[model samples]
Target: MDELDEVLPPEVTATLTEQLAGWADGAVTLAPRIGVALVLLGLTALVAWMAGQVLTRLGRRTRLRRNLVDVLRLVSNTAIWLTGLLIAVTVVFPTITPGRALTTLGLGSVAIGFAFKDTFENFLAGILILLREPFRIDDTIECEGAEGRVEAITIRDTHIRQTDGQLVVVPNAQLFHNPVTVRTDQQFRRASIICGVAYGEDVDEARAVIEKAVRAVDLVRDDVRDIQVFAHAFGASSIDFEVTWWTGSLPVDIRASRDQVVAAVKRALDEAGIEIPFPYRTLTVNAPVPIRSVDGQG
Candidate 1:
């Protein structure tokens, strides 16, 4: 030790002694309690970090494991923070009672409930969403007029990827009250398209063209043999025709499929010299007869 002492600066020892003397002699006091609190915090942080690493390793294997990682992280972090807080309370107030602590906790919980009521509700909602399995990740769902594939469901909100590539976050509270429509929940969905043609166009020919268009779609269902194109209506502009098809076990890009079907029908009708007519309103008004008053003031 004496041979290794040369590395220490001479002022280091002097400063150390002066500080210790000051603490011991009551001239000054360093808060050992503060140091101890920091130590406890450091220990909790280390444990939590280690837990995170384990969870991350598991997450790499599967998507389900990835979600579990978030859950484990939350539980581990909360437990560690609670342990640190207990230690802090015990160290700061040596005479504190465990029963009194319980009472305090009860009261604090009530206050916390009032303060973070929405937060707690959302947390519980997340648990229910996971357990009940109303929908799964990547399932196409519609709620509150927003349709998309479910990106993820976290504690606060459920995220979805819209057809337009938008990220939408819907609050759990709203979900609890709102009715959700899971399109891909049963592994299939039906898509329908409405097209109008001129009255002079051959209805059978137009129907054949629509059937061909539906068939041309790669993702369109093969069992769609019940397609019917009727004289839907007599419009001020043109006749309306409806084409419907059934789909099952299809991808989440159903909108794209519908757009494709529409495009195909337009092209097919255009090639057949059939017009998808647009409404043309012509307003006619007659000039009012000149009003003549009995007094003939003009």
Candidate 2:
């Protein structure tokens, strides 16, 4: 150490020591600023959360649609956080002017938008969905081969609870771009079933029986319209009748009504001696040739 110190000039060593001391002093001075920045960030997050809660509660109190309420809450929360972030940045860097900050943000946003194109696409789609409300929460919807009730809608995805109890998270872009079928959009939905009877049984009689049977189901609604029964097609085994009825739009209602209709139809057909025939196949063999003795043996 003494040899290296002797090789170096006294002036250079003194300059290096002074620079190290300045750096240490600068670090000490900046520590408080960094701490204040962290505190500002925490406060910003807290304020954003509080704003979200208030907006959500207020939205719920109004008559606004659920999706619209969520959207409003989201927008308000975002605005609050953005304001907080700007303030925190200004506090941290006292010399950065707001105009310069905005300009920098504008440039940064373009790069971020390109980098996260799909994410931004879903976000925009989600906002539009919340604004337009194609389907509401708990609405039964079919889209992209996934049939389920909407559980929740968020900025990036929609949560759907399937009939088999599976939860699916679908991107908002897919929902917005594709066609969705809302099965429970109306109060009543049409339920149809095909029933077949033996060809000998009268088609008109079968139709009458089916109409009566389906109408008798408690879940089936008869006040709006009468049940419709029509001869749909001649099947391989039995003549088919397409019976249509109005029922509650829910899946459970449709299933229960169908069960009742099927039971009632079976009972009515049995009582009336109308046979629901199964497919029957007939095979015939021509008279077999007389057996001949092998090797010319009679």
Best by TM-score: 2
Can you tell me which runs of candidate 1 are displaced by over 4 Å? Answer: 1-46, 61-68, 91-94, 130-133, 136-139, 149-152, 164-167, 184-188, 195-213, 223-241, 247-256, 259-298
Clashes of each: 1, 0
Scored against the true structure, residue 129 in model 1 reaches a CA lDDT of 75
Candidate 1 C-alpha lDDT tens digits along 1-298: 3443576666786677677887886432335665676888888889889888877777776555355468668877888787777787665566666567768888999999999999888887776676576888888888988888888888678998987899999887677768998888775566776788888888888888888887888767656545555567777667777777666634544667788888889999999899888767898769876877899965
The TM-score measured for candidate 1 stands at 0.60
Query: Which residue pairs collide, candidate 2?
Result: none
lDDT of each: 0.76, 0.85
Query: Candidate 1 — worst ten consecutive residues by lDDT sum?
Result: 25-34
TM-score of 2: 0.76
TM per model?
Answer: 0.60, 0.76
